[model samples]
Target: MNWLVWALLLCSSAMAQEHRDPTLDHHWDLWKKTYGKQYKEKNEEVARRLIWEKNLKTVTLHNLEHSMGMHSYELGMNHLGDMTSEEVISLMSSLRVPSQWPRNVTYKSDPNQKLPDSMDWREKGCVTEVKYQGACGSCWAFSAVGALEAQVKLKTGKLVSLSAQNLVDCSTAKYGNKGCNGGFMTEAFQYIIDNNGIDSEASYPYKAMDGKCQYDVKNRAATCSRYIELPFGSEEALKEAVANKGPVSVGIDASHSSFFLYKTGVYYDPSCTQKVNHGVLVVGYGNLDGKDYWLVKNSWGLHFGDQGYIRKIGRELSLNLGKQSFIPLILLVRSQCQKEESLVNRRSVYKTFFSCMFAEFFTTFKLKVAILLF
Candidate 1:
């Protein structure tokens, strides 16, 4: 190689480094603002020791968001800027107790059933506002309560916000739940059934931590008899279930760094897995520019994902995650007397038996005499 060519290449490399220094400083400032003092301090150490290649990849992908017009999703540095993929998984992913899933339970419905092209429970005034799970791993509780809230709105003509705190506190190890550490949606449902009902978010409130079960009987607002698990590996069944049965609680692999820093557009992580780690709610499904996507409601606050929602592509199973999704259906009980709908045989009358009192009046001579005597 000529001396002139070598000099030019070295000069270009120097200029590239100079350009990236400002961008790195900008990210450092964002990191300090997003996290608290403790987090900031820990991340400062992590950031300085971060791999150069990873930072470069992040900057490259973010640059491609604007440089490439055909890209479906946008990525940038967010709360997960400093953490590695392993750290993200340890902190965020929390779904557990898959081995305890009930056996002999048959999904009576067909997966091939036709479903509507688009459906959103929020439009029908069933879904509650987006919620944040905070620093705790209480996503299972949030997902459970979200499904219950939707069912309550459907059962009675009232949209009530159920409490995730109730599940976090009450559904302890006794019910096969590990509180904020990790839990299953079905276990939460069973806890609700065993403990009469769950309280409203207004009365109970979310503390985002594990605590003693301080549930008050008077505060009970809604109850569920049982919950069902959708047919494993059947996206069709999941779609149909969400369309007909309000929102369904689902588990996904939210361990990717890109998933953590997701800002907008349809998110499709090729590295996502079907191991079922994070719990979220599936509210609806729709298509965009020939690409079908599931409208997923996340518990990471309004700032995360697409306003706490993500559009998972319909089918582009390149990596191991594939298109297989895990979904569990929770059924709400109208009242106690209403025998828990016959889920076993799939044939039972689910009627609301209401007790009423009435007063009668009569002008007849005999009736008037009896009234006067009484």
Candidate 2:
């Protein structure tokens, strides 16, 4: 054998030996034990730091208060790294959510409301498996596309799966980002309105990899004819809009710790107070135990939320911090003239009198004097 071939073989053998195998570990038990030890140690340190060093009697009375909740499962140190299904579920259940959390609130649903039925798509049907781009904060595109796709189904009666990847990659508006970066849903909606509509996944499949903007016009799928913006922070108004219209695009905050650790149906995030990001969407209001709840669908895969959906009520309003912070989208139901009818009539009367007076020099001079006296 040649010396070069022998050397290459030796190197290949070494590389094979160094390769590591990937194994799945159930780490929920380990997390529970680790948290137990850390909690005890931290409590002691906190007690000493507060009493002997600071000369404080009650730690709670101090200017800063720490509220610690128990964790039944261990959230792995890294994102999506070796967390067991049980641990994820327990973590979601053990969340210390506020009693007045938005999920518990209710809104009135209009009986005569029109909603998207199964037959809206052209012939394709409703698309499933839309995924969430976590931490990257690109929920705005997801929300906009989610509603847009649903609207297409309602109109065409075909369940055609739309591509969120196209919006995230192609939209170059105020709220759009470079795939993984953050963006706002309203901006994405505006982008769609201005640029016709987005393409289907079949036309442009998702790579899960961000690339340069390369939109192909022939692949475009659907277009939005009109968008009805609804009021923010007013559940009554939003519910009414949903009932009257098909769905209204909305934005909400989803940065709570529980939101990140969610793994099951039982949502219990104690730190629901801290919200960090915003997402947009379509809504369907319904009743549960005589209380109203917003049936929110998410772009994340089916494993998250209630099968890629969330139930929020008035208490969970804090989750909509972004919605509250900005001006709500308002869709005009009445004509502009009708909305200002009295003012328009008054302006018309003034214009008629002014025009008549201006046609006559003497009357114009008299009007000037009358105006000065008034």
Candidate 3:
């Protein structure tokens, strides 16, 4: 039989059965047993394909099945809606994330700090609240604009939501199929900076459907005048930028089921290290149980993370490997205090001042010599 045909047959067999909690409906077990032979025979190849494609690792699938079983067991005990602490713990424990980094990896001391409550207004409340991108892989644009929006609010004290569609359609530095493939957030940031800034969502609404780029100079889709790169993905650098300068752009590994399944608080999915899909911003950081973690704001939606925030600890270096390699690229903006401070604080200040005076004295002396020669 053709592999495609066999795969289709297996999928059809699995889809034919309804998935219900066995405890809620006792007949499910009997149904499973009756159809078990036929189901296995039909879907064995399909299961193998899923395993070979790395979409469904054996251990992870096993854990998911175990979690479902426990859910069924809880339902039998009339604790369906309200799971016991032990039961909840057991279900959580059954979560097996493949491609987890070794627990013994050494961690550097994180120099990042928390965002002041005063500046909390700059954070992206949720990605779901913003326009959707559908199947378009313009996640990088979404992330870049999302961070820029917050940064603008932080710097200007004005809350104006920017458009991701603008960056998707307008950016020329990168290439992809209608923004459906992928691109880097850094490139998008640079595009925004060079172009002045992007427009407000109201000015240029998002067409979740892909279309031709209609560049309207009047509305001028929002743009940024500058981009300040940080010294690596230091949470401290991010916090300092937010507190002192403005909100910063950041990237992270978002291509995991755990990211989609995130409910509340910090999520440390061992699987994040495997597939790094999404990029986001680190707006804040906080200490939990004497351990420090970043307050990552994602562009997926409010349903993801702790209301759109993920706490990542310094120990989990695997998820933030790219951040560790960052070389700070601060946009040079003229600040009088910074400029004056730079001149007065350097080691050669006295030397530079005396050298300028000595040059002036020589020019005066040389002018007299020239007059004498004439």
Candidate 4:
């Protein structure tokens, strides 16, 4: 109500706008050179510079706010800094969850049983190197292959990177998977089972694009018999799976831009949607400064999010997509004969991988609780 108060507020706003880091250009130049970014035209360079600067300011302010306990996580300036939100969404998201999937299965192996307080598959030497999916919506493939790789190591005593491209290209026909566009992890597993086996990363390799299916059955290095699912919105179900099973694949809502710039700290945003859009792997879970968090392994390159990983709030991550109420919580289980661990009594496309192979090798193999990981 006073002129002095109004004048001070206006002056403060003006000062804020006028405030600019004098070393912005130097930092911008360094980033461009490091990322090998070369603009074709001057206008393009200027436009990108503006967007990149906006991100710098945004992340800087966010880190400050979160440090003060205003937020749960902090943002970072990575290779995606110059990219617009639309581009990030297009490049980052590729997970496609069927609106309707049988959800009548819960692998609750004695919930009252004692469980580990924390667990991480990477530390156990089961997880392969963190990979980059590039611009492919083939996150579903990466998620499936990541879990398979861990399982293979657990059973075989060797860490072998599996081919995601094999699923991206081949898993499309038998299953409803779209190579570069979108796909499901469960269907990918079924595809591998139906197809007999999947190729190793050395044999098939990843191109991060939809290419001609050149699958070689002789190169099949790993096989998965069955996967299970847990009840939606149940934290204990996932925690148990990660602790007992190797790594569990799951989906999360990555529609927010803040998720794109996510760097470190426990990611807990009320604004983050429950509509799962991207597929990821939950490698471990534990408490951080009294806050429960799930240690997630991302397909993005090592430059993004705490060295290609993020810690999501482990409380609630239920898929609320259109018409999607229940999804399987994936877990690995060993079966008898051809080892066709019974498919959860539901309308599933699960196929048995001829019981003649060395199913005897997997003694400690347990059930995989599915949670729409693809």
Candidate 5:
């Protein structure tokens, strides 16, 4: 598949329904039985099994290095172990449409205002329970709604579960949000603003697919006045945004293999690039074992990376601001195929649904990034 072009075997994540030491010969049978994985041909199964074994080796080696403290996180096996990188990328990829940048919205960081050194909206009783986006690439709606949910709670003292599916279905027409294919949080936000308000999840519910619009304004549960775009390539700006403001919507290049089986510890990867593809929420920031980290929430389900939460190396994330829509402001802007990427076939493949290589890259550039996508 193309990634739009690379063909390296990669993985996304789903909680493993069946578990057996990969060293066992019956592990494949157990895995197939658990996830109900099926293939049309015996040869196809052989090819996929080879990828699975390779993924096992990748996780083993990474965890071994982690034991020695060479890395911050450990890799694990999941239901997605049998899939290739291309297939995973297509499923997890998110799209963002850059805003026209309303002249009124400005990211003015008040140097005079004293801000908390750390913040976690979850601890403040603002963020709702972690949600699963299932198989749909509807992360844009989740990211936007997650942030809006926090803002609503912080303002009203009632944590309401907003409807992402509302945006997935109704935010399309004039807003250009592509429902399941993908969308931008800014566009999602705009849809909410224009429609007066969005409905609660209890009212609209989420089916994880493109459905007809049934957005009832009477059931409107939350709304945002406007969305702010942080100054690009600055970690400080991101820190302030999360600390001062409520949970903030952000984006990241979640295409690196390191993020696929990510289970715990501060996630960072040297192979990540400035290719933003997913949208997520940044609920807070703090230090962990001497490493500065950002508390991120994903829409991939409670099984993804530490109970649906992951810590990104906050200090060193490359937040590249391309000319695309949201990139200048830490949102997954357009990564329209830059002529197509070259296929990379490596023994230990490093492909992803969202990548971590930019953590190192961001260190030099001092940028901020985040991730999402179902």
Candidate 6:
């Protein structure tokens, strides 16, 4: 409380504040450089303000444990920073069908099967690139395509990125794929097999919108012999299938705020419902620092989550598996399909698994500013 001590404290605080500003400035500059093209259509000043406010809120949230409990993860500003929960749901939570196995269809179940303590398809070089679905509720199409792409690589030693646009356009009538509005991955696979295959992503590039059926027989890249549904609520069986077969297309309740802001660590939102609202590909499972997690590949782009991926807590989503397997992708392709495009050239969109070294960088920067100014 002495005068000299108080003055010294104030000066020290000012120095600290000056120290923190540069770090935040660096982060803001980095974000602008990375995402400037995406926001170029908007007013640059307005966009910067919005981004700055969101980043501040993210820092506050990151430093405090929410009412839900101490989060096993951290969240920071991302492409979805400005959206509300309802907006996030409308754009992201698109899957509608209950993932229950059909009572009429005889399905295989090995609910008690043993699984590896950890698995990563990326390690095996079977996973494809992380893709962005934009504002389209086409997560089902992407999930199905991801599984099939991995299967293609596993079976034929060729990794071909299949087209989600094919399902969006063509699978509406008979297969009941609702294009961007919503659809089931099972129905998408059924449509692909029924149509004799789907075209490559390059041949039928994603527009992220519903359009008229543009099925090109000449450009068919891969086909499925059959799609199999894994048992509902069987985490062990799902793990076995994923470890032995390849990636499995699974569903998760993707409408949580925690999910929207997730940056790293094993995400477990106790409020997340068991209802399958959005579809994503489960590429593997593992434990980190005593926490079990399902490594999911999402279609929200590299700027979202852990670079377009999420490590959701295994127990919260243990029973949400559906349409877990895809047959060989090359089993039904024609000779013309093989020769028209080189699969190697088409694999340019490949993504390495994202590292979480940068999660603390933004939050720590913002927290320093808060401590200094106060």
Model 3, span 216-242: residue lDDT tens: 656653444345445544545555555
Q: For this target, which candidate reaches the highest TM-score against the unseen true structure?
A: 4
lDDT of 2 by residue, 128-154 (tens): 444655433456566666666655555
Q: What tens-digit string does per-residue lDDT give for candidate 6 at 1-374? A: 32322443445434343333444666666665767634332333343344355555664676477435576777867777655455667776687574444542223445565667889998888888999998778998998899888877764678888899988899896776688888888788888878878998999999988898888988987876556555545666567667766787877777766777787777776676666678888888888767777889999889888888986555444424443332111112232333333343555312210111122212322433223222
lDDT of 4 by residue, 334-360 (tens): 323222434433233233333322333
TM-score of each: 0.76, 0.52, 0.55, 0.81, 0.75, 0.72
Worst 10 residues of 6 by lDDT: 352-361
- The C-alpha local distance difference test score for the whole of candidate 1 amounts to 0.66
Better of 2 and 3 by lDDT: 3
Poorest 10 consecutive residues by lDDT, candidate 3:
72-81
TM-score of 5: 0.75
Sorted by TM-score, highest first, which candidate order results?
4, 1, 5, 6, 3, 2
lDDT-better candidate, 3 vs 5: 5
RMSD after CA superposition, every candidate: 13.1, 18.3, 15.3, 9.6, 15.4, 17.1
Instruction: Report the lDDT tens digits of candidate 1 across residue range 1-374.
Output: 32322443445444344333545666665565765424323323433324333644774676586467746677655544555666555545577745545453334455566778888888999889899877667888888888988877876667888889889898987877887778877778778888978999999998878888889978878877567666666676667778877788877777777777776666676667656777888888777767777778888787676777775544333112213333556643454334344333334343322210001112211343234323
Q: What local distance difference test score does each model get? A: 0.66, 0.44, 0.45, 0.72, 0.68, 0.67
> What is the lDDT, from 0 to 100, of the residue 340 in candidate 3?
42
Q: Highest lDDT among the candidates is held by which one? A: 4
Q: Runs in model 2 with CA error above 4 Å?
A: 1-128, 173-176, 263-276, 280-282, 312-318, 321-374
Query: What is the clash tally of candidate 3?
Result: 14
Relative to the unseen true structure, what is the C-alpha lDDT of residue 337 in candidate 5, on a scale of 0 to 100?
14
